[model samples]
Target: MVLNYLFRRKPEYRTRKLLCFSKEQMYEVVADIENYSSFLPFCTQSNIVDQNQSELKVKLEIGFPPIKEKYTSLVTMNKPNLILAKSCDGELFEYLETVWKFTSVPQGDPMTCIVDFSIKFKFKSNLYTHVASVFFGKLVKCLETAFINEAVRRYGRSSTCIFEMTSQD
Candidate 1:
């Protein structure tokens, strides 16, 4: 069976997408979180709360234009990648839990992987959700493009690369 979820807090305007990447790229993406956190548009800040073999706690600042607020979350990144965060813990924390699964492509390329992502939560309000969704789409696209560009600039074209996204629509 396939297990997946989508969570939102309507009036509060907080949403998250749990997307998967190939197994080969799994750890690579995780490792880049700290370095790239500041680069995300709405994310004003990200702090490493704790680190060990099993869990990672992070604090972040989410911005909607000139207004900015803080959020904190603890992720249980043990065997499976689990993102458990709350907006209440920081200056403002809301409950959000997202999980990611990595699967290998057995047929051809060594760099290939399949990812399954799931998320569950509540949104503050529908209006906030709608607005953020529209703005975030553009923001995420730009951020992803920037990420790829940064990778190319740092490593050149010859570097091993595999970037893919799966959608259920």
Candidate 2:
């Protein structure tokens, strides 16, 4: 029991934020996986190996100091509502999944939306897992900011409202 406790999988991290962009705008920002390297932190390279209307197979390489790893993920898109990406092939990860949900703010401006984002992942190496667990929250936050920044660059800032709520287990 003690060993199990010591070696438990890391908990998922989730965050909700109000953005100045519409749901469709945010969806386009996330669904553009091939452009991730341009804005996403630690992402050195991103390429779509295969792509269709509803899904894509993406190869991504991320580097963090002494650790640099490449992985392939299957990304599924549900139009302007949801985007899901799961690691399908990788030597670095035991499992990895990210979910992005976007919805129109109730009775709010049509140009505004709420984004719910979550990530759950485990590394194949114990050392990697430990290192990642320590910096997971901050890394996730940076990723979220990167996306928002990209949106601002593409569509221009619509509002100054930057409300966010985050949770990490």
Candidate 3:
């Protein structure tokens, strides 16, 4: 079993709600590619290769301790609702994908949003995997918090919010 652990790859995923923030507000925070470095941990650089009305092609350089990786991705969005990203030409990851879905709070209640964020990735090298495992939890929390922080920075503090990891894979 220990030997299998060395070769096995695992996917990480989490879903949480960001209450008191509108769907549009939460969606905007996730879709903004250029401002990632300023708020996202380990995001050293971000570049937009191309963009259109519906999609964006971007490259991001992320460094986590001993590992630094650069990857390009194609991002598409369905306005205030969903954001999808797929890894493009990249050397570090075998596969990397992220999905974000924002749902509005029920009518007659405070304007709130439920942000569901998930990521699935596999590094080409096992060494990267081991290193990532050490920082995985921190990495995930940082990513989620970055968006929430940005929302507060842009919008305002939310007195009502429920944040939790729905699951992991």
Candidate 4:
């Protein structure tokens, strides 16, 4: 299905750079991240309709204030390397694509989960997309913090999972 009618046309998006963990380790993290809404606090509902060792179909309910938002997506787990997912068939965004990559360089005991991700999201031609992109930074921070906290919560401080952003400068 198409996420939005905008996709009736073609779409375009771009990714920036990345930091943390070796490529292998990053890939592991990406694979695990497919079920991220499962752990993210802001997410109210995450229904994994189907799954395998490396893929998922999730129905997600995310909190954003005015109203709760729901989106169902088919995510492919490009393990130990990349996890790319797009808007299911009929959804909000006209077009959407997110790519996540992991890279790691031995960092002593704990392995850094350096993640490089790009999101190309377009709306039905309006300011909504612009507004969302503007606030996306904060949302990403929330995700990062929650992700790190969850790592500690699950793996404990002794575990080797470092979720830190690398400097682009």
lDDT of candidates 1 onward, in order: 0.50, 0.87, 0.81, 0.59
- Residues 1-169, candidate 3, lDDT per residue (tens digit)? 8645854756576676656788888888898889999999889899999999999999999996786789999999899899999998868888888989888866734467777888878787788877676677788878987888888888877554756645433
lDDT of 3 at 95: 83
Worst 10 residues of 4 by lDDT: 11-20
lDDT for 114 (candidate 4)? 55
lDDT by residue (1-169, candidate 1, tens digit) is 1111122422222222222333544535544557655555566677877778766677766776777766667766544333343444623423455454455666845444554454434445444455554465465456555544554454454654544454443
lDDT of 2 by residue, 21-128 (tens): 999999999998888888999998999999899999999999978878899999999999999999999687888999999999899999888899999998888777
Cα-based lDDT at residue 54, candidate 4? 70
Q: Pick by lDDT: which candidate is best?
A: 2
- RMSD of candidates 1 onward, in order: 7.5, 2.7, 2.4, 6.5
Stretches of candidate 3 above 4 Å error?
1-3, 64-66, 108-110, 158-160, 165-169
Cα lDDT for residue 89, candidate 3:
80
User: What stretches of model 4 exceed 4 Å from their correct place?
Assistant: 1-38, 106-110, 125-127, 158-169
Q: Please provide TM-scores, in order, for all candidate models, with all chains considered together.
A: 0.60, 0.90, 0.89, 0.64
Error of 2 at 23 (Å): 0.7
- Residue 153's lDDT within candidate 4 is 55
Pairs in steric clash, model 2: none
Better of 2 and 4 by lDDT: 2
* Residue 66 lDDT (model 3): 80
Give lDDT: candidate 2, residue 112: 89
lDDT-sorted candidate list, best first = 2, 3, 4, 1
